[model samples]
Target: MTPSNTHTRNTHLSKESEQSQINKAQARYRREASDAAAAFMQFWRKTKEESTVPTKYKELMQLAIVLVQHCRPCINLHTQICVQVGCTRAEILDAANIALAMGGGPVFEYIGYLMQALDEFDPPKEAT
Candidate 1:
């Protein structure tokens, strides 16, 4: 079976794997095509990791952009990053709503994926 198929199949069994798919794919590509992958990763670091904007805001903007583009993996990746950078659910939804306003119905439909990803990566914290 294809790797993507395996990722989908394993989703119910391993949310951890789901979150790592992008990292795994990047590792495979770097191993298989070292020069090209290195260049792309260098570019990724410059744009994503070194942004003048705060990482939290950059991650939120990325989530909004990917939601509009209908990229499920990117949405999941950025959602996880946003939470890691300390975004609350309200902030995540606020970023997501920008996509809805810009892309309208299609984006509205896909917001479900954002919701699912949010739940997967950052479920609500239980109150003490």
Candidate 2:
């Protein structure tokens, strides 16, 4: 296993750029399987859009799960979106800790990616 500090995101791309790639891939998939992709995205919206769940908490949960999954594009997209929806640094880190508890050492390395994402996305507002 790599050291805990190792980050696996593509070295040259910004987080937004990573998200762009994911979007492009999604577009391609949608074109390739238009019906299935649309249905899946509809389900995606049903789960991810909104309801009784607050956006901040929902995104925190997503961040934790994605961190454990070690999907760099997901981490990049969700981290920025987490900040945009007003997740505090502490809240984000706490969610990361939950992932760490389940994901162990491999997840620890991925937290390095989360930290950078938080830093980049976290604006200069007051953080909890």
Candidate 3:
């Protein structure tokens, strides 16, 4: 009796372990999230390094806004990067407004999604 009970417990545990492994394999990669984050990082690095542009930061912010409006994950990643590089909330909102003007109602709908993501990943408060 004791041996049978122990065998059943081990079998149950083994099945759970196998299921978890299968789930992980099934959910691996997630290309959209990975790709968007990579693209945002690459663009951010390039935009920051170039020296010829007039109002470089603003230009970068404008581009970031367009990227964000098109891609929600890109918006979250780039917005966080922008905040790291001294972008203010007002500036971000302004860039988003510019996107709204260019992309219209569909763009406006995405703003709420982008804002939700930004709020989720808000930068830490700087010391005064």
Candidate 4:
């Protein structure tokens, strides 16, 4: 099998490998990519926290979608937090759709990753 196929098949082979991917990503964010991520996040946080945007949560969520579409790592992190804080899934996704609506095909590809992050950070719970 090709390397891509091998990795895809191995992904289901064990939980360790799945976890390793997550760990690797987190480590990269904290190490090699931290400085840039930190600066980006700081600016994002300041904008959302200090600004008087009419609909801050909604606006931020939309911004997150656009940033994720643009592959901005730090914005993705804050976007996840915004979702947890109060932004609805629909609102977040609408933002993503806006990106596709304006940006066309290339921007659409990132929707899955954006949705995946949204799911990971804001998973649905069983109603009890």
Residue pairs with backbone overlap in model 4: none
How much does each candidate deviate from the true structure in C-alpha RMSD? 6.1, 5.3, 13.0, 6.7
Model 2 worst lDDT window (10 residues): 3-12
Off by over 4 Å in 2: 1-21, 123-128
TM-score of every candidate relative to the true structure = 0.73, 0.79, 0.52, 0.52
What's the best-to-worst order under TM-score? 2, 1, 4, 3
Count of clashing pairs, candidate 3: 0
lDDT of 4: 0.62
The superposed Cα distance between candidate 2 and the true structure at residue 62, in angstroms, equals 0.6
Tell me which residue pairs clash in candidate 2.
none
lDDT of 4 at 24: 86
- Cα error, candidate 4, residue 49 (Å): 1.5
Candidate 4: tens digits of C-alpha lDDT, residues 85-111: 566666666666777777787776666
lDDT of each: 0.82, 0.82, 0.64, 0.62
Clashing pairs in 3: none
Model 1 accuracy (lDDT, Cα): 0.82
Better model by TM-score, 2 or 4? 2
For model 1, the superposed segments whose C-alpha errors exceed 4 Å read 1-11, 14-26, 123-128
Model 1 error, position 68 (Å): 1.2
